[model samples]
Target: MTSPQILIATLVAAYLYVVTPGPAFLALFTLAASRGRKSGAWFICGHLIGDVVWGALAVAALVGANRLGPTLFEALGFACGLYLVYLGVRALMTRKDALPRTIGAERPLATGMAFGLTNPKSYPVALAMFSAIVAPYIGALKAADAPQMFVAAFLGFLLADATLIFTAGLPAVRKFFLTHGVAVTRVVGVIFIVFGARSIVDAAQGAMRKTA
Candidate 1:
């Protein structure tokens, strides 16, 4: 088990990663601007669940599943990067005058989950956190302790993501976004595209480094 100090340190590290506006936040921002606050909240719920699962899987990989895990995740990263870029392009091309349609609960939830699960940077960031902050303290932890570690890491993810979603949905924030919805969407689209391009470049570099 991790000491209390180590646990706190790990959560703090995770928050640093989660709070940074990355692909995940870019995706959420697009949804909140185009759809609405309710949809953004649902998306946040889905993303939180995905983060927990990803955190657990990262712990499992470190514990034993490394043989195939890294390769599989890299491939997913490439695919997801492409998809994100496409979404960005689509957002930019949204009809000039038409308002964004109200998104159903299921759509945003599923979209958020997919974005979280396939976020190209997540695995690498988690690995870095483990090496820099977590592994130093819990290197001696047994496999049985994986679940506890996973939960600790996920708390940070939940808090960071939930905060962003709720803040974006605040009445003033939402009204401003909804008022200039088209402009907001275009801005988010640009952010997504740039982020996606970066993901692709990073994934390619990682793959090359692995092969070399």
Candidate 2:
């Protein structure tokens, strides 16, 4: 594949990575509904930090997984999984009369940074998304290609972030969230729990395999 093709593929992978619904999506939805688009935008901005870091790491891993090995990410996955489960349980325990407590409500940037960085699924999911789209071109990738790929992926993330901000700000979307905030929060909690458990299991399996 040519440079342009690889860049485009990487962009597509990044876009899909951000747009996929998960804990971050849920938090954004809650913030947008409760506060407004500005808060959502701030959240996205904060999350951008995590996106870039994870994206770069994912690319590095793609280029050098054999050299770096999976141990570090596996450990991170295990720790993040536990954190997610804790958050999920807290959300599940939210009172019916109260709005679900979102982290970083008072400080969206910090909350977003924490969410983006600590998300259990981000690294693996980003890796899988990029792998699915760009694997065919891996052999053709040179050291110089990494910078271009990163730029393409960053652009993709920006586009998705804009889309999410728009979606979160829509009157209809906000209204729906307002009406069903509790239910939605609970549902998200369930999802987080499931994702966390899966991460834990996957990490444990990886460890076992490594030991064996």
Candidate 3:
């Protein structure tokens, strides 16, 4: 179990790790690029919700720190990897004019879940960092226990992703629906491929580790 300072520090590290580019990053970025910034904001919200779910799962012991063996994790990883590849391929195949993603009410949340859940990196990072950091707090009866930590993580996730979307993705958004949209689409398409391919490789490594 981690102490308070250690717990907070762990979370900062975890948040920073999440903030770095991964499937979630690419997903949010791509969504912003395809959809408008407002849509990107919702997608970011969805990502935060997914983080909260993961954190809660960790706290509740639904996902154990060590219980998820390499085998199981690897299998799960494969599922996410394949899904990302499918998305990436689809994005690449689309025409530039088709990239303006006008989202209905459902898609913002759905896309968020799709990106967060489908990224194997999200699980390991959450399982390893999020679970471990909050494990000690889970036992405490204090108000600053699980809920506080969850809020902190959620907020951290939102800010970090929102920054990226606003900085890089928003411009793409304009190009998509306004001008030079096709070029932006192509870039996003490449990004999806990169993100998806990376997921596949990481999943394979995990799988090999399990077998070995």
lDDT winner: 2
**lDDT of each candidate versus the true structure:** 0.62, 0.76, 0.53
Runs in model 3 deviating more than 4 A are 1-62, 99-153, 164-177, 210-212
Candidate 2 lDDT, 1-212, residue by residue in tens: 33898889889978877876566887898898888899989999999999998998877765564235567656655665676577678778868897644556788988899889998778866765565566556556666677888889899999999999999999999989778777777875676576667667766877897799
TM-score ranking, best first: 2, 1, 3
Q: For residue 134, give model 2's deviation from the true position in Å.
A: 1.5
Which digits, one per residue and each the tens of the lDDT, describe model 1 over residues 1-212? 55676567557656655654445655566577666677888787777766776666656655552345455545545565676577678778867785544443458888777867777766654543343344334335456666666677778777777788777777787666556667766765675566556556656765897899
Give the least accurate 10-residue stretch of model 3, judged by summed lDDT. Answer: 132-141
True lDDT of residue 5, candidate 3: 64
- lDDT string for model 3 (25-79, tens) is 5555555656656676777666676676665554434133225444444454455
Error of 1 at 158 (Å): 2.4
Candidate 3, residue 161: the lDDT equals 66
Candidate 1: residue 45 Cα off by (Å) = 1.5
Ranking by lDDT: 2, 1, 3
Candidate 3: which pairs clash?
175-181
Q: Which candidate is the best by TM-score?
A: 2
Candidate 2 regions exceeding 4 Å error are: 65-101, 178-212
